[model samples]
Target: MNNKSITAFTLLTATLLFSLIAHADIINTNTTGRNTFSHRLSNLYIPEAVGGETWFDDQNQYNKLDIVASGTAAYADITVAGTVVGTTAEGANIYATDNSGIGIAYELNYSTPGATSPQYAYVYPNKLTFNGSGYSLNGYMHLKYALVRLTQFVPAGPITQLPTVTVNYHNLGASGYPDLSVVTLQGISAQPQITACNINAPGSITLPPVNGNSLVEGAQGITDAPQITLTNCPGAINNIIYDFAATYYNTHSYVNGIFTTKQGDGYAKNVYIQLQDATGTGIHINSPLTLPGYTGSGNYAIPNFRIAYFIDSGTLNTVTAGKVETAIDFTVIYN
Candidate 1:
């Protein structure tokens, strides 16, 4: 979890999602000569799991009178906008804590109303989590939050230190004032580090088969008994997205989901390549493949994955003994 807070928001505007009658007085929290507020939501460093909670306190006590005589103080839809790359809003499992405590009483519901609409389903004055399907995030992620009461709100305890709403009376010869304040929420933005990996020796992969003819004739092809190691990648990278390409072997390029070698000008015919994970499982070059278990902090070495040249005896019928060589381009990436 290489999570870092890239920036902070100086101001936020309140927006009304549902129509509500106006009667309650509005007071600025910034009246105290302070326009900025800070919230430490560092817990969102890594996206919260589907059933996790990202706790946060607005640091503001709710004390606004009902605009409709029965309305309560509540926060509404979390409006999300701004630029995101590598993953879509749907791909990123973003969710807010709808209830209190450990959030275990109710089942987890992972849903979003497309990208345009702000995601809702949480009570106000609580914490929110990016509760979306797990995906390593890249580029920038920003979310805007707003508050609105949906129903009558009752404080668990006494309300104190609220601003004053004054009214004067001449006929009745009495004056009364109510404590009041506005609910202003802050926005959050983060930029987690991208996935990176360094290969040991990527220039040339030489496969020394037992013999050109016997190599293709044998039932099993060559294996990376001594795996080529990869190192220095972020711990968040659980898997690698990779593909292989070879112009000469373009006709017989993809074999068993692995990239293959080309028909050389020399002896090897119908020759191809096969890639396996550290566990010896064939890696599908078309999609992302899980990397070896990371140790949190250290260079990651892939001990199981290896590549070897194989000849399709059935197609070529004859395996040439002279020169069995073909160039291959191996590309590795983590999503």
Candidate 2:
């Protein structure tokens, strides 16, 4: 089903409802120097369906160590039903794995105690489509179907590199769901490039229905379709560097021209407008990056906005204009 159908995470819901598996990517997150990739979210996002189980507890077995333990790797895994019917499959091998020491208890919210988490209790998101109910055969399956979410986390140090992720949301229908898979990203340009009317308008971004060389397997909606926005490093040659963030939609508006970044995290990248305004301009920094701006307009001009990220020098540079609107989006890529 589509991401919207994936449902919200309520308490320990996704964990108890579906068949589960937990495992870590054999690959570990890369850590170098200077903290370039630190503070960025992983491209991979756990489905609400997979939230809340005891599969990923830091204390259960994963060694109370954070996902970024022993370096900077965020680790977790899933267990699939692997059959037409689920929950009570006879002789079904529980194919999930976690970090070498972690038990099924280390989870997305295991670390943040006393704080609200996306996972908790038994409330499920409205996004998922459950074609069939999973029940343990003779009460055995329900006991083992418990699982947990795989969350990407930063433990203590800064990150230098981000693990590349390719997420595919599968299936749009209510039943007979689609599956998710990673695919090689492609397409320099795509069809559906819509135009605009005003200077603030971003025109349109062309995105294929599915990302990479292969199609999505079980889920659907914006998950399958991925857009690639390249914010080239300005003036930096030889060692190529750029900032990247993956999201569901191609071009997203802030609903009210309002966006917020955490204060201490040091994350305030530019909103790289792909198709600059009709006047060949794009917005960055928002001038008063922390202040409010006009997002509403009676005019037909659609102010283009996306959760875009642009590269910074890693260390803060002397700023005359504060952290607000650095320049039009293109400035980050073009000299």
Candidate 3:
């Protein structure tokens, strides 16, 4: 009975243990960063031909994501999911808008500490991997659009309300699979006008050979009028402004409409060239002139334009000629 009581009195002790683990979520702390960007296609002055040119590029402009995480650094994969409008000829993704001839292109980039270069993915459904430690994420959106001459047409006026696509970024490693952000990039607001014109000018204009002895100072020697024809002009244009410049000049003098010729070997000496209007009025070089009665979309011959060889009030008696050749440069501005 004593042994049984001693055995029953023997103390019994038990220990219960519990373990707890903590996990920190990855978060973008830059709350004030803008997610919506506006782009304007008209301001780029895109050419009529389909060349797959980048009309708008936000590479310099980026929405930065300041990532903060707590735990042992681990690799996490991020993905992009959005509505793909189409693909470019080079196989790049195109996020289209309500406006035609203009669309969006996007890329996701990630960088970690001591990384030589950042990792980027432009094509959709692509995953970008990053270390869960201190890292950065940048989202870039651009406009690398092509113009379809047959199907797409420029708007009559500037478009303000250009619809865009909504893109979602997901953290595949996050618990329950949470979205990093929902972004909608808006195109830049601008009043863009596309005015294109094709010019037809002779490669070289020749004047009748004249005798240098028959010319006097401050008098015209040989005169000629060459035509500058502008064709394939869009009907939406209102005016065409043009100006001229001398390629080779002996001196920096372009006083009235006269510019000096090159004064070296194979060049005429004491000789000058002058630009004039139809009334023989000396038109100032580099002065912009608007085409008269320019309606739109047709072939037009520039009026009141004439080029002539003249001698200035300098030493005309020493007018020795070897070759009286010069070049003229012209620029046309369409509005």
The models' CA-based lDDT, in order, is 0.34, 0.22, 0.53
Which window of 10 residues has the lowest lDDT sum in candidate 2?
A: 135-144
* 229: Cα error in model 3, Å: 3.4
Q: What are the RMSDs of all candidates, in order?
A: 23.2, 30.8, 10.9
TM-score of 3: 0.50
Which numbered prediction scores highest in TM-score against the true structure? Answer: 3
Residue range 224-297, candidate 3, lDDT tens digits: 56688887665434577888788766322455677777667887887777777777777777878888867544
Q: After superposition, which runs of candidate 2 have C-alpha atoms over 4 Å from their true positions?
A: 1-54, 57-275, 278-335
Q: Write the per-residue lDDT of candidate 1 for residues 229-294, one digit (tens) a residue.
A: 666443333355445455454434343544544444655445556665556555555543445565
Number of clashes recorded per candidate:
12, 57, 5
Q: If both were scored by TM-score, which would come out higher, candidate 2 or candidate 3? A: 3
Angstrom error at residue 89, model 1:
35
By summed lDDT, the worst window of 10 consecutive residues in model 3 runs over 142-151
* CA lDDT, candidate 2, residue 260: 30
